[model samples]
Target: MNLNLRAAILHNVSDNDQSQLEDTIVDAIQSGEEKMLPGLGVLFEVIWKNSSEDEKKEMLETLEKGVKG
Candidate 1:
């Protein structure tokens, strides 16, 4: 079977409004299920690709703090 996970994830959420997207993210993180990691990673990939340099730097800084915390 051939499956494009990134595309599938995007398709699933294409119609989601801001609130729905926020809920989906919160639900996925709170679930703490291994299966949700890939979807989160894909979301992060999209965010990373679309972020500005300053935004990326901020994300890295936040990630560093999170790791240290």
Candidate 2:
């Protein structure tokens, strides 16, 4: 079976408002299940593609802090 996970994840949330998107993210994080990681990664890829260089830098910095914690 061909599973286009990134496309599937994006399509699932494409119609969501900002608050709904936030809730989805929060729920995924709080759940801490391995299955959620792929969806989060797809979301990050979308953010990375659309982000300015400065925004990418900030995200990396935040990620660095997160990892260090």
Candidate 3:
């Protein structure tokens, strides 16, 4: 069976409102389950694609700090 994980993840969360999306993210993070990493990666991919250069820089900076911290 061929599975398109990115598509499946997007389809599941595409209709979520801001609050629901927040809940989904928080729940996924708090769960610390390996399966959730792909979902978060898909979400970050969408965010990175839509973000401006400045936003991407800020995200990189934050990620760097997070890694160091």
Candidate 4:
């Protein structure tokens, strides 16, 4: 996960307007594509990096519920 590569991927996602990226994410999750999980990890990493501690705590709580459900 090079920062430069991650930035490039994020830039590409942003430039493409995220619709396709959303679809890909949905497909990956629904299809249980384990490999695609890393992409999600990257996304979470980006968000977590920029988020406040409270936001991160809330996100983690939400994720825990999602995982349980």
Write candidate 2's Cα lDDT for 17-48 as tens digits.
99999999999999999999999999889899
| TM-scores of all candidate predictions against the true structure | 0.95, 0.94, 0.97, 0.62
lDDT of 4: 0.77
Best of the two (1, 2) by lDDT: 2
What is the overall TM-score of model 3 with all chains considered together?
Answer: 0.97
Displacement of residue 62 (Cα, Å) in model 4 is: 1.4
Quick one: ranking by lDDT, best first?
Answer: 3, 2, 1, 4
Which tens-of-lDDT digit does each residue in 1-69 have in candidate 3?
999999999999989999999999999999999989999999999999999999999999999999999
In model 1, the Cα lDDT at residue 35 comes to 98
- Please give, for residues 2-44, the per-residue lDDT of candidate 4 as tens digits: 4675665577567544688778678778989777777777777
Residue 32, model 2: lDDT of 100
Error of 2 at 40 (Å): 0.4
Which segments of model 1 are wrong by more than 4 Å?
A: none
How many Å off is the CA of 38 in candidate 2? 0.4
**If both were scored by TM-score, which would come out higher, candidate 2 or candidate 4?**
2
lDDT scores for all predictions?
0.94, 0.95, 0.96, 0.77
**TM-score between model 2 and native:** 0.94
